[model samples]
Target chain A: MNITLKQAEKIIAVAKEKSIEIDTKMNIAVVDAGANLVAFARMDGAWLGSLDISIKKAKTARYFDMNTGIIGELSQPGGPLFNIEHSNNGLITFPGGVPIKNAAGEIIGAIGVSGSSVENDHTVAEAGALAI
Target chain B: MNITLKQAEKIIAVAKEKSIEIDTKMNIAVVDAGANLVAFARMDGAWLGSLDISIKKAKTARYFDMNTGIIGELSQPGGPLFNIEHSNNGLITFPGGVPIKNAAGEIIGAIGVSGSSVENDHTVAEAGALAI
Candidate 1:
């Protein structure tokens, strides 16, 4: 199923709450099952540079069906997925991207966060995805 | 000021209503002032190929602050902007893209619509932008 605007807002709201909790502004993005952007938000003071990164992270997670941090680990210089990130016209494999699943355990979409450290980004992304 | 998720949803809703009035399915995209994606929707049965085009159209409109149809006219051979479509890594220099302005007349975002005739796409895009 595609992500409705309502669901997308829910994800963004959770991301915002998590960002506030961590005291870091963030750029949050949500993409549909087809990896098309569904919703996005750039918190005040969020880094402009990371806006597109948030979108790409969600795309990367959807494209591979895994968290970007895990993808980063697998894409290391001689690893199995070496150079895989380059395949999708550039991927942010470090962290902060997570696939979103429905109650049936089907992947419905994905959430991506940026404008913070990799660890914090991942945490925010996780909060959003789980809120779905 | 950025285009929040709430505003994006309002644009999408108006576009959907216009698409129905015109008897066509459509892919709609919205982007903030910085030309980054804010929200996107592909109505059921919309053409798959026009998905990314809708996003790019919004970006094109935001980049030049003009409707894509006007850009298309200027990009015609022998025109001042002939070949300009190829300048921004490929732009949709046709109809269906419009800049979105706030109540104060400040451009805050843009809307793009596709998956129908050029005329109908432009009509739908206009409806969305005006809804803002």
Candidate 2:
């Protein structure tokens, strides 16, 4: 099922709170099952560059149904997915992108975060995914 | 919201000061958090071609939350982000771009400068970014 705007907002709120709790600003984006952006938030003082990255991360996670970081590993120089980031307009195959699954374990959407380190980005995104 | 014209003008002011102090002609551009152009200035006698370069550099810095030079290094052949420059329309991965931050240390926008060496470009952009 596709994610609704209300659900997307909820995910963003949860993610934003987590970012604040961690004392970091973030650019967060949520995408529907179709890989389209549903909701986005660029926290005050967040990285401006992250606006594009956060959205791309969400789309990448939903497109592959896997963590963007995993894709990054697979896409290393000699890996099978090499050069994959060149596809899909431009995918961010780094940490901070996670798929959002429903209670039934079916992926319903995805979330992405950027601004802080990859570790923090992934942490914030994971927290948001659990919201859905 | 995003960076305002008045603030962007202030950034340009500092950047222009840097350019003058360094005795370099520069084309400077500032973009708001949305990556939209906010304010720009081309020093008298600056290279005509650098106007576009300055704008693109600012946008590139905001697109990935990293210095354009760093992106340059990462996009080198055999690097993890090889060929990335071809993805985002066109990105100047050399140098001369810096993210502007507000008092909260949030990236409110970015500044890009060209017309001189990459080193000067970066220095001027950094000076501008500190305006806000």
Candidate 3:
């Protein structure tokens, strides 16, 4: 299964809406099932560095098929997947990434949110992933 | 040690067919084991930004002898391969790049596709790689 350009745009729209509702500017990114970037948006005044992080977060979630927060936990020093962030160019193991699924309960893509606290980032990403 | 233009074209032809089958425009590139370009094709209305990405993806696949997606999973921040992309200009660790093999299962080259969803890109590239 995969995501379409229209679907990617919808994900971004919902994510942007969530960021506005929270009063936090954000960098949002969506990647299709293969973990390649499909769409991205950087809100005005958003942290520039976060633009890359947002995209990486989206890719990471799709690569592992799990939340980045859980990856963060598993990647802790001495943990099972420790040093995992060292793979895949660079992965964001913290919160803010969520998988997007289709009506068939199949993962179609993922959304990543940044430019705010990890909690806020996760919240925004969740909002976007639910759009479909 | 390398791929011929004829073979590269054949690969691209198959890839293009798959791309058309999936209804996605794509920029496709084929590279020999030396990480050198052998052939390329840009589907009508493919993403211009992905032109460079498609080439780099082919080179990255050849250099690593594995799907870029797998390399991505191993190169996160704390993973053993963190910063691997820094070598050889920059590697595209995401999907859509696949290694080509000959009848003896020997690595010959790689194919990369960009445009539409990563799922479609990879599907097209895989079809191309299998042609050889």
Candidate 4:
């Protein structure tokens, strides 16, 4: 199933709310199952450098069908997925990306958040993905 | 000026309306001046393979400050821009991508359309780019 624009907006809103609650700005990106951008928001005062990182994070989650934090751990040196961060042009194998799943437990899309500490980014991204 | 999510949604709406009027499914993509994806939509039944092409087209337009069709012509063998398409990780040097400009005529971003015939793609992309 495809991720509708309304759903994407809902995810962004949830993530933005969380970011504000934590007193941090964020660049949020939502991508469809095919890893194409569906919606994005760069909050006021968000770092410009994190703009693409948000998208890449979402893409990495979708591509691997798991959260980026898990991937990061797996891609550590001597790990089974070592050097995977260098794949797919470049992926953000960090904590800010989370897979979006439907009631059927099928992955539909992913949400990525950046512009804060990795832990905070992950928190915001988790809020968004869970909202879906 | 950066293309806000609201502005990108407006552009996509215009393009989708035009696509409906022409009875064609489309993959529409928008990118900021930095040639990074900001928003994208793949209408139901749009060719899946055109997904990446749509993003690439928008990047090509932003990179060259012109339409992809114009770039196609200039990049022809023996043309001054010969082999230019290969420069930017492979540009789509054809119709369907247009630069997005502000009131002062400064390009702010770009829009790209695919899934329909090249002519129809260009028409829809132009409609979106003109909306701003």
Candidate 5:
């Protein structure tokens, strides 16, 4: 199942409500199960940094069907195949990223965000997920 | 502050405790403030797909000062500057990525992961962070 446009909308709405006075800029990304782009957005005044990150998070979610944070640890030395972390396109492995799941508990897609405090970033994404 | 070798080691330890019998291979990435690679590792049997994504997520965390998940949302259309989502490095924009924060709450670096399920990836990363 693919992420519906409605779900995306709810995410946005929640973000708006949760946004703080930091006037933080954000980069958001949505991808399908195949790890392909479905929709993307960047807030005004958002940093140029989000460009690469948002996409990576979506790809991680799609490819692994898990959050990037967990992937980050397993990629470490003596963890598993630590060498593989640097082997490819150089995706990230950290927290502040989550997957988008449907009612059936199957991960249909994912969403990632950046450009604020880590706590705030997680809060916004969490809000989006809770909204959905 | 850069992520020390010891911190990377801790992240790996937490992952080992959290990993399940899914035999999930993981790709982990660590980066400094400039978004340059500090350390990278990929577990054996890990999917080849993580190479690019792990790097991108690190860059995202470094550049955005937040997590990849938050950046994902701002990349959407009608959100802010969605067009920029596709620009530069073709990085990902989704969850499963996070920034590494020091005790002062300042973002010193970041970590990103891929492979296995999204939840598992997040769990492992979270475990790493908590361990630190």
Candidate 6:
């Protein structure tokens, strides 16, 4: 139901540890049980565009309770209506987003990171999840 | 990254199979490589509130490359700024979202669903992810 501070630290630490010489800036977001925002972080020099996209990714995960990458597949030919990105609203459909669960496997919140390649983004996210 | 139509169909099929007597309506979203909308669907009686949340979740995933649930934690005390939900721009942070990855482990896109309880939303999203 709540996003603990401990989890956030873990995500940051993991990102720093895994970060390579790329010195890539990171943008992270956390959401609550109701799919609301709980916390957010943007590393210095991170892309400004990544800020909004990062937060949106977390919302996608919390709202859907699934991985954003999977959502991408559903938007293809013969998929659903395929109208997530162009909804006129602030909805975005992409990868690099994930969810967080408690010991009981209940989804309490989520995490999203940007400012890197999709693979790097996913790696950092996985590290954060495992840290928790 | 690329999300295929086959994956979307699988998600829908699995959701129908696992649905209980709740007769809950479902809203599904899919995104593409650029974190843009590709496909989307809403069940007959689904809640309208879920639509924006669902797509935002997908975008959050793509932007952050992590789960939305984890993002929630960083927004708490001493965490990140915790401003994702409150950002002037439209960014959602919640649960019931997921991501789709390619064989190379590249983040292709994401998926999000609404119109049910958090648990139900997650279940349906999970089913869709697994279908791929």
- Highest TM-score: give the candidate number: 4
DockQ metric, candidate 3: 0.03
Q: What is the C-alpha lDDT profile of model 6 across B31-106, one tens digit per residue? A: 7767788778877645444777777767766777765545544544456645455542454445567777777788
Compared with the true structure, what per-residue lDDT tens digits does model 5 show for residues A49-78?
876787777676566666777777765533
Model 3 / residue B14 / CA error / Å: 31
Give the higher-DockQ candidate: 1 or 3: 1
Write the residue-wise lDDT of candidate 1 on A52-94 in tens digits: 8998999999998999999999989989999887777789898
Candidate 3 per-residue lDDT, tens place, A1-132, comes to 788766876788798888999999888888888787666666655776787789889989999898999999999988999989889889999999999999999998888889999999999999999998
Can you write out model 4's per-residue Cα lDDT over B7-94, one digit (the tens) per residue?
8878998999999999998889988888877777777668878877898999999998999999899889999889887787889989
Report residue A78 deviation for candidate 4 (angstroms): 5.7
Which has the higher TM-score value, candidate number 4 or candidate number 5?
4
Residue B90 miss distance in model 2 (angstroms):
5.4
Summing lDDT over every window of 10 consecutive residues in candidate 6 chain B, give the lowest-scoring window: B85-94
> Following a full C-alpha superposition, what root-mean-square deviation does model 2 have from the true structure?
4.3
Model 5 misplaced regions, further than 4 Å: A21-23, A81-83, B1-132
Evaluation by TM-score, superior candidate among 4 and 6: 4
Q: Candidate 3: what lDDT?
A: 0.84
Off by over 4 Å in 6: A20-23, A86-88, B1-132
Q: Name the lDDT value of residue A23 in candidate 4.
A: 99
DockQ of each: 0.32, 0.30, 0.03, 0.28, 0.08, 0.04
Task: Identify the runs in model 2 with alpha carbons over 4 angstroms from their true place.
Answer: A4-6, B1-26, B32-35, B38-49, B60-93, B99-110, B124-132
Docking class of 3: incorrect
Candidate 5: TM-score? Answer: 0.49
Report the poorest 10 consecutive residues by lDDT, candidate 5 chain A: A78-87
Where does candidate 4 chain A have its weakest 10-residue lDDT segment?
A36-45
Residue B43, candidate 2: C-alpha displacement in angstroms: 6.1
